[model samples]
Target: MRGQFPRVFVLPTKLSPVELDRIEGSVAELTWDAAEAQVFVGKISRRERALFELRRLKVLTTETSQPMRDHRSGIPLVKGAKTSTRRNGTDGPHQYQDTDSAGHDEFQPLRPGHIQVVRLQWLEDSLDAGAVLSTSNYLLYEGIKVENDPQPALAPTQVSQASTDDIAHETSNRPPESSQYSAPSQRLRQGSRERRTSSGGRSIAPQRPVLVHETTSEHDLPLPPIPAFLHTTYSCQRPTPVTTPNAGFVEELKKVRELRLLEGDSIGVRAYSTSIATLAAYPHVLQSSFEVSRLPGCGLKIAELYQHWREHGSLAEAVEGSKNERLAVLKLFYDIWGVGDTTAREFYNKGWRDLDDIVEFNWGHLSRVQQIGVKFYDDFKLKIPRSEVEEIGSVILGHAQAIDGGFQMVIVGGYRRGKAQSGDVDVVLSHPDETKTLRFVEKIVRALEKSEHITHTLTLSVRNSERGQTALPWKGEGRHGSGFDTLDKALVVWKDPEHAKSPHRRVDIIITPWKTAGCAVLGWSGGTTFQRDLRRYCKAEKGLKFDSSGIRSRSDGSWMDVETDPELGPAPDMVTAEKRVFQALDLPYRPPEERCTG
Candidate 1:
């Protein structure tokens, strides 16, 4: 057996005071990656004890480690960290303290007769500590059990009195005892009870759902297992009751989805969105990775990643990728209202790392809209609660009516889709007389711009993208606009008039000719994928064109003037149009709330 000489194993830290202190002082940016803490400390080629003893590899005790210091600066590494005077002529100027595993000393050199198994494990603060402590899921070497102590080894007060401004404020280097790491004995070798993974790998309890394949004999087509109380893959098939049973899983996937989005991976975002929507609609607690892999939106890649989570009780990819330096910087710039994914990447390529970089050195390159985005980065990050969205909608509604009582407004987008908080508020505006609404966008901007609640005008236009016509809602190649950016709209910054520190939120007002009010509302009320599929269904299946304004017949390139024609009109409106669009495509109508697709 080839034994590696003694080397210090630096376990990656998360929410602990040790890590938080580093971040607070800007000394080290703590990595949120789950896998960083799980890498093999040393790869062993053979397990024979006689061969290993011949190599004379040394064991490292974490407790005996001395504090590390910079070579030039000679500054202490971690604050309040105890330093040892004894240094065994190490190469670096400083050395870390030597100690056993925080939870136990099970992590030791494997004997000639034993095979050491390195597995991912989760460590949690004891439940008896008044509050359920956040999970500190990590990989633990030297196989252990899956339980935790009920009492915390270290208290918050121990960390509270430390210097908030120093990275060296760690209270103790000793890790708490964990219940998950079980010392391997004779019983562990006889793997009769646990589900065995392939190739003598670590095994965890499997929670595979009994999949009852629908019509086990009839259909030649391959289909996924039907989950309990569900038959169709489309989200609209079920009520998708509003609940938070799958918040952790959903949130983890969303971070990935958002990461993909920031990196300009449109296809990846769409794929992840499908899974996100499915997980959000699921009712049961996700007990195992197998259950998540079987769901409609998930594929093998996602399934495998989730399996790691099931084994460790922590998301592996989420732990590592979310804090990736490039991705983090990209997300910061990409989230700016004016910046698109393409633009965000461009900024990154130019060495613009963050808002500060843009403001300090490259301010001249920013467009007017980007300047506004930079100015209110923090405000835009704040979500607008459902109540605040309604308040803003009411303000806009009141303004529209005052201009012309005939004009109508309907809040669409995420707010209309039942989200408790939305990144921005979408409100659709229309008037029966298409001529009167021709320039209503300009009028609304003028009116809203005067209000104390309006902080900045991000965008205002008659027809953004200014394309004459489209096959769908901006889907074709060389598309002139941000697929949904072509409609006549006003995008503004809004805040509560009373509170000076109120969050500045994004609000969009779309104006459609009253003749096509229904089509407009249908277009704007999107979960992204739903709208894309809806349009594709129109063009390919029905030979009909669909967009924000109205539907048109592809046969002769003529508007489907259902409402304007007296013979067809019972004074048709948005609701009637929405239903007819579904009918024209021979699809069951899904409500605005159920369009949580893509």
Candidate 2:
């Protein structure tokens, strides 16, 4: 049996040389035994004892090599017994007692020489190896082993004839007591009496005792189970709902399905139009919404819509409000050059709801460019296809190179990312020699304008005086007003006469000098809010000022000297320069496609 049981050896920590030597000696001296053995040096915490007991019990019961069974009946021992017993004077129950011996009376108390109970304890400061050996020996004697044990015996009284009524009455009528044996003893006594009366004096075999073993020290006895009613009294109660007075009308309507989609529903369209109106009328509201939950045009209904979009996967409504003919015509008119909501609304109020009305009215309000925009309104709204963008790029590049041998041009907006179509073409013009940047921009625009490609132009000159101040809107300032000096370049929007006005197509050309090329590229290649965020990060975190020209130091009022060399400069252009800036600030560079807040 010892040989059948596997050996288990454990070490709590790395063994020193001396400890290793001792282990070697112990192993060399261990002799082959039929039963299994394990050697461990670790301290076992109290929590591990129960698990160890279960493992040991399983091994002993199921893995023994010997086929030894009950000596009297030659049957295997029963497992998982609910009942077992030992006479008061009998040897304390052996760990692995057999169970098939009926009509046997071999069980007897510990005789003068048959049994021994030895107790020993180690001194508090003891370090003697001999004391450890003694403890091990005593443990070995008490340890359960199946090979050397005797069969288990039954009790002296059976309860087979006890009526169900009598058993129930006996259990219910019993009083709680501190005595260890009182309850079982009373039950057994009642059962015995009832059996005798029911059987009419015939002698019967005694029943098994319901044995229970508990290992607590005398200082720790088991407590009784608590009554069910006592537990219920201490449990937590459910919370009551509280009423709120300020909940909005839409919220108060339990069955309301407030629509909130970007492009489809009537309510969503109104909400979106309201948002756009709010942004145009009160741009400050955009910044305010980031901090507080309340703002003009941002009522509970809209807030609820934004919150729902952020949390749930779907919106309840879409943004194309009831399709009014006037609204559609106004939307179409707003797409033209030099026109805005105010002008569109003015036209609507005057009964000029369509393009034909504006043409027929023949007003002084329509400028030459606006007239062209109205003429080609449909085509201008359509995105410029990739092939057209390339063709336009070739035209601009050829014209630019022809003006100066040193000139270079790059397509820098969404088109640069290889998009299928573009809203407008953004070209970055530069030269290797920084001194010629001003001349380069002037000559390219001149050359393009001479080709009859220029239809309209808005030129802004950079205000060097306002370089140190921030551009954020201040109190009392109008929404569209940014009180900063303008740049010295022209923003030319033109119609391609070849791509005529039945669907009038237009191109926007932004020309900036080489000195502010990087900043200009970043500014124009915008999903507007993204560029704003990048600028904010530069100002707040890096203590650097960013604008169309370049990044500069805020503390000492010095410019960042970014050389124009292909390999050594901050970057070849603005896109790479922005990546470098973000990397320097330890932020991931967000790609253009993901820039849309929607």
Candidate 3:
């Protein structure tokens, strides 16, 4: 015989059709006598065996019933009996647990070797065999041996106990299912442990990590114990302390908490925290929490506020804690046109805390626009609802579409992003002919102003071409031109109605020609920082400049202007243009909604 005995491998489940064919091919290539052509099958788990039995009956009745004979008797098989003999040297029956609570008496053999082939195919179809073969968990065969004499099978009682023990062991040892199964956090912990072991016999001091805890009442709650792995001794220099304004800093924390609650889980909470951290003078303020929980930088006391917000809308004992006074001061300082946080802080330290104080003592520091900002501080703070934004967009769209037959206008911003409420409206206008957009902006602004809807106007100009260019000296020219060839002329309008006492509602309008529609749409439909990073990526890595106009190469030192003439060929529309840019740079064109980045 080419091989004296047949080797059987256990599988987790039944095989697919493709896998069954592969197993049959391998078996045909092997040379063995009819008596020696024995094949044994094993089940890896009880659940797998149950599933296999269910599929085997279906396959036997549908495909071939003749193959359902018992190997030893050559008769149709019955369950609960040892139908096939073991390899010559084997001493007992293959002891396997009953998969279901019911006995295996219902299970009928479909074929003598069919189950073996099915089991083998199941393993081949489901798993990457190469990956499994390389793993420590997989089984490998070195060789096989057989004896002429066979031994007696095991008793039924002995088989039952062995199967029960296997069940208990598997339940205890199997890993739990988790969201991060592909990129398990345990891998990081393993790496850190490995590093500590390699560093030799030096004792390291543990650093104090911040812990946050939620409060039951007004008083602070105790923090949870640090994880054991974090207690590892390692010496690293402490980071430099950050400076924070002593005046009304606590109140600002409360406002941040309020904003967090109002925004809820959907808004980018981490981004908001990072923005605050970067702006705050004291770095520890970033760590401060209103609740007692495991906030990254905050500890027990601050974690209380976070918990309060989660459970209730307002902080219990902290309602009157400098919040009103601080808001008044902030509102006053924010109105000064040129004055931001840095300038406002200086004024606050000088005892100028209110609008009257700022007007009297800090008039020289304030710009004309800041004076206007101070004048309408209360009105500006009110949020514009989605309904109002829609009304305003419709009004603008009506006027734009009336002027030109080819013009198309789309309302973007938070409304387009599917938010329930919006702060302001952003409308983008484009037309088929590039030349038609030249004087369209001015005409649209005049039309809206005449309707009595536009009460006031601010910052009306085409976005300058030189806005996002790198300042590099040219190799062989008088001067290197800007990266952006076209600029989007934007108009900011203020809508005032007789019903509302407020001065006007803010609306941002952008108009782009057909040639630059793709870049303009992407730039305008932004969460701000996302578009900035995209431009940065194109310039720094791709040696290409991208803006509201089009993409251009630094090497050519020339504009790769998109042909906008529809008569000539296909004009660069949003989808086609973006695809072209991405293809040229060898990067994927991401959808507008997924443009958010770090």
Model 1, 1-598: lDDT tens per residue? 1122111122221133333222212211111111111122221111121112111111111211333333223444353345442222211212223222234222234333222211112111111222311111111122211223333433666443323322131223322222111221111111123322222222222122222222324244444454653323344434454445767666777766675566454444555665676676666776555555456545344555565655565664455455566667777888898888778767776666778989998889889888988998998898888998999999998988889998778899888878889999999988776666776888888887787667777778876324433323433434454244355788888877788778888888898776667777888886775665565556545777677766667666566754444567634556676676565556777776666643
- Which candidate, 2 or 3, would have the higher TM-score against the true structure? 3
Residue 392 in candidate 1, Cα distance off native in Å = 1.0
- For model 3, what is the error of residue 302's alpha carbon versus the real structure, in angstroms, after optimal superposition? 14
Candidate no. 2 TM-score:
0.42
State in Å the error of residue 327, model 2: 3.0
Residue 330 deviation, candidate 3, in Å?
4.0
TM-scores vs. true structure, each candidate: 0.57, 0.42, 0.44
lDDT of 1 at 175: 23
| lDDT of each residue in 63-102, candidate 2, tens digit only | 2243323445444333232324322221133222323222
Compared with the true structure, all predictions reach lDDT values of 0.52, 0.39, 0.42
Cα RMSD (Å) between model 1 and the true structure?
21.3
Cα lDDT of model 3 by residue, 156-273, tens digit: 6534534454445434443332110111112111111111211121111111212334234534444344333211110000111122332143344435533322212112232233
TM-score of 1: 0.57
Q: Model 2: runs farther than 4 Å from truth?
A: 1-322, 360-362, 367-369, 455-488, 493-504, 539-545, 551-575, 583-586, 591-598
Candidates by lDDT, descending order:
1, 3, 2
